[model samples]
Target: MSSSASTTSTRTARPVHTTPIQQPPSDSTSRIPVTPAVLRSIFASSRTPHEERSISRIAFFRFAGFLLSCVGISLAASRGRGIKTGAALLGVV
Candidate 1:
């Protein structure tokens, strides 16, 4: 009879649904400890051409750095290497 009583009765008359909610499938991707092989695969699958080119460039630089490090290490570990090679490896040449 009162407004508050009528509102309460109306709220109580509504039924609650019991259906379970569905979830999407999980598909994860991560970019860490990036290597040339990984970069190449990522670049191939990428939709944007510009980003792929940038990734390729980064891979090139990464490979170049690895080669340079190998050369320096080889020169350092060789028994008969001169002081000039050592100085060069140490960036004082």
Candidate 2:
């Protein structure tokens, strides 16, 4: 019983050793270079209700202009018949 007790005491007294995990060095080539303009575009503040509404309005207008341009180009290329086909293709896309 004393031998078992001594073994238990020695086991409890021993300090545990551990090595900290090391992180891999980051490669410069893997990182994308972000310009201030790109950062501003990505993280633009739209906290206010007015700013949110304005941003939404701007997006809508931009999309409408793009659609109109596509339709205009399609109509010019194929002369009116292509509008339906183009619209169908756009819908599919």
Candidate 3:
């Protein structure tokens, strides 16, 4: 009886206490951090000139193809627009 009661007390025991987190007091006099300038400097350090443009070209073309697919699907879904498919088939020949 005593062993079972002790086992149940151990299972239900409250956790050991721990110290609370400590931090510096807030200071209104501290200069507000400038995020944009820091971020700009970080990006500026990694920048390359024409290589960015070349990447932009590839991304633009990939996006253009994605846009064209939506247009093709829209055209195919319209009965009158289905004529574009016949035009495409003709172009292949």
**TM-score of candidate 1 on Cα atoms, chains taken together:** 0.38
lDDT of 2: 0.75
The residue ranges of model 1 lying beyond 4 angstroms of the native Cα positions read 1-43, 79-93
User: What alpha-carbon RMSD in Å does predicted model 3 have with respect to the real structure?
Assistant: 10.8
Q: Compared with the true structure, what per-residue lDDT tens digits does model 2 show for residues 3-38? A: 544444444565565776677558988766789877
Q: List the residue pairs that clash in candidate 3.
A: none
Model 2's TM-score against the true structure? 0.37
Q: Write the per-residue lDDT of candidate 3 for residues 1-93, one digit (tens) a residue.
A: 455544444456675767777775678577566698897667656868676677669989999999999998877676664677767878953
Ranking by TM-score: 1, 3, 2
Alpha-carbon deviation at 24 in model 3, angstroms: 11
Cα miss at 35, model 3 (Å)?
A: 11
Candidate order (lDDT): 1, 2, 3
In lDDT terms, how accurate is model 3?
Answer: 0.74
Q: Report the Cα lDDT for residue 82, model 3.
A: 69
lDDT of 1 by residue, 17-72 (tens): 67767664454454256799887787588557887788779989999999999998
> Which residue runs of candidate 2 sit more than 4 Å off their true CA positions?
1-46, 80-93
